[model samples]
Target: MNGSHETEIRELMKSYFDGLYHSSSDILRTVFHPDLAYVNGTTGNYEHLDFEEYMARIDARTPPASRGDVREEIIERIAFKGDRIGIVEARMTMMGRNYQDLLTIINTDDGWRVLTKVFSFVERKA
Candidate 1:
C-alpha cells in the first residue's frame, strides 16, 4: 500500500477509537460505510447491527469521557490486501469495558470507510 494510503487508514482508525471514547456519532459516521454491519457475540448470543442501528445506540448513550472513563487503545495491526482493501485489528476501552475489534476497510471513490466490524467484549477478571 502507498504510504499516504496507509496514513489515511491509520487516521480513520484513530477516528474510530476516538469516536467510541467520545461517543460522537458524527465522527463515526465519517469513518464507517453507510452499509456497515457490526457483529459482536459475548453475552451467549450474537448481536448484529447496521450502521444506522449502531449510530442510534451511540446517540442514546452517555459519552465514556463524560463518565470519567479513561480512554485506552491498542492498534495491533493494519494489513493491506490490495489497493482497495485493508484489515485492522485493534482494542479499546469504553464505558469501563474492553472491546476487541477487527475492521474490514475498503477504499471507495469517496474515501476509506470501514465496511464491517467483527468484535467481542473482553471480560475483566476479578
Candidate 2:
C-alpha cells in the first residue's frame, strides 16, 4: 500500500481503539468489520473470540476504562495481496506493556475495514 493508504488505515485503527476505551461505540463501528475475529495468548493461555461475540462481552463488562493515547510501532507491512486486502503487524503499548497486534484489513467500497485482529499480550515483569 502507498503511504496515504497506510496512514489513513493506521489512523482509523488508532481511532478505533481509542474510541472503544472512550466509549464512543459509533467510532468503534467505523473500524471494526462486523465479521472480525480475534485470538490472544497471555501468560501461557490462548483464547479466541469472534467479532459480534466479543463486542457483546465488551459492551456488557467494560465500564469505560481509562485510555492513554494510541502509539503503534509498525513492524512491517506483510503485503497488500490485492486491491481488497492487506496485512500489517505492529506493537502497541497499553498500560506500560507492549502488545503485538496483527490486522487483516479489507478495502471495501467505503474504505478500509479491519476484518480481523490477532494480538499477544505482554505482561510487565517486576
Q: Could you tell me every candidate's TM-score relative to the true structure? A: 0.94, 0.74
Residue 19's lDDT within candidate 2 is 62
Candidate 1 per-residue lDDT over residues 25-103, each given as its tens digit: 9999999999999999667858999999999999998998898877889889999998899899998877657888899
Q: What is the C-alpha RMSD of each candidate to the true structure, in Å?
A: 1.3, 3.2
How badly does each model clash, as a count of residue pairs? Answer: 0, 0
Clashing pairs in 2: none
lDDT of each: 0.89, 0.71
* Per-residue accuracy of model 2 over 1-126 as CA lDDT, tens digit each: 577777777687677667655665567678878888877766576888887777766666443445444444545455677677888776755555678888888888768888888888776555
- Please report the TM-score between candidate 1 and the true structure: 0.94
Best by TM-score: 1
- Which regions of candidate 1 deviate over 4 angstroms? none
